[model samples]
Target: MIIIGERINGMFRDIAKAIREENGAVIQDWARKQEERGARYLDINVGPGSTEPVRVMKWLVEETQKASDLPLCLDSTNYDAIEAGLKVCKQPAMINSVPAEAAKMERVFPMAAEYGAEVICLAMSEEGIPKDADSRVALAMELVATADAYNLSPDTLYIDPLVLPCNVAQDHGPEVMETLRQIKLISDPPPKTVVGLSNVSQGTKNRELINRVFAVMAMGNGLDAAIADACDEELMAAVATARILLNIDIYCDSYVDVFMKG
Candidate 1:
């Protein structure tokens, strides 16, 4: 599974403080720890809290690059911030998303293509989050078409079928899984499917339990990646075990080695 480390986001209080203080030391420490723990991409979100996200994002991107060679997932709803982060990125990274809205597609896809960055397209739109599998598939199709028009190959587009909180809607996880399966069925050489794995347990008491169960189910239904807490040992163990069970990795040698170093 493609693990995008989610700890560096500005939504977290400590990280927000670190960013506000321009603490390169704290940011570098987080990046190094995530990389050492086996994260493939480190997700950097300026979030809604920052007034001057572009400036902060540029600094974060540069600092992260200085600390590690692992690619970043430049995350922001602000197009300018996304562009700034992309500019400072040393490697081809992932844009942490565009929704199904036409305006979003127009703004983000061109940048993605120009920078040779992979993209994550959320299965949401101007009409708001879809509640059913069919509507979700329709939104995904629209995103796929938009990417194609920009000459961005399917492999470079990661489709996130927005996993909802199971505590609020018990059927949410199954619906998302069905949507993922449908996307794979429709696309010729389907785009990679991913999720914000923590979304499944939001507002719930047994968060780790919900996250692991939903992750295994999502992987079984063709999920290839996730944005999750790289520091969570239980979640990481679940991810490693799921990969072996799904036959994505042979034997568990790589997984074991990763944990041993941790």
Candidate 2:
């Protein structure tokens, strides 16, 4: 499974302060640490912390690259900040999202094509988050067609089924897994499915346990990647275990160690 590190996002207090102060050391430190913790992409976001998002995004992209060459997941609703971040990114990266809405697809698809970047398409639109599996699948299918029209391969499109806080939307958990399964069956070489895994346990007591359990569950149901807290050892270990069990990784007694060290 692909791990997009969530620690660098400015939603966290430390990250928000770093972004506000343009603290390169703190930002690069998080970037390097996440890379060492087995992240495939470092998700960078200014969130509500940045008053000058475009400038801050450029700084973030450049600063994070100073420590590691890992691709970034440029996360923002601000189109100009996304563009600014992409301009400074040394590698092809992932766009944190576009939704299934027509205007966003028309815009974000072309941007993805131009930058040779992948994108996460939220399985939502003007109707908002669907409460059922079928609606998510329908939105994902539309995203696939939009991707094709832009000449962005299905592989470059990551469809996020959009997990809500499971504590509030208790019954929706299984529905999301079903959505993941349906997303893969949409086409041959299906659009990859990802989730913001931490959202599953937000505001809950057992955040790590819930995140790990839900992550492994989603992996079993054809999840391809996740934007997650890589700093959580149990969470990462669980992912490694799931990968090995699913035969995505070779088995060994030291499998977890090997996966982490690699």
Best by lDDT: 2
lDDT of prediction 2: 0.90
**Candidate 2, position 18, lDDT:** 83
Q: Tens-digit lDDT track for model 2 on 43-147? A: 998877478989888898999999988999999998789989988889898998999989888888998999999999999989899999999999999999989
lDDT, candidate 2, at 104: 81
Clashes (N, CA, C under 3 Å) per candidate: 0, 0
List runs of model 1 lying over 4 Å from the truth.
252-254, 259-262
**Tens-digit lDDT track for model 1 on 88-143?**
88899999899999888999999999999999999999888888888999999999
Q: Please give the distance, in angstroms, between residue 36's alpha carbon in candidate 1 and its true position after superposition.
A: 1.2
Model 2, residue 198: distance off in Å is 0.7
User: Which pairs clash in model 1?
Assistant: none
User: Candidates' TM-scores?
Assistant: 0.96, 0.98
| Candidate 2 lDDT score at position 140 | 94
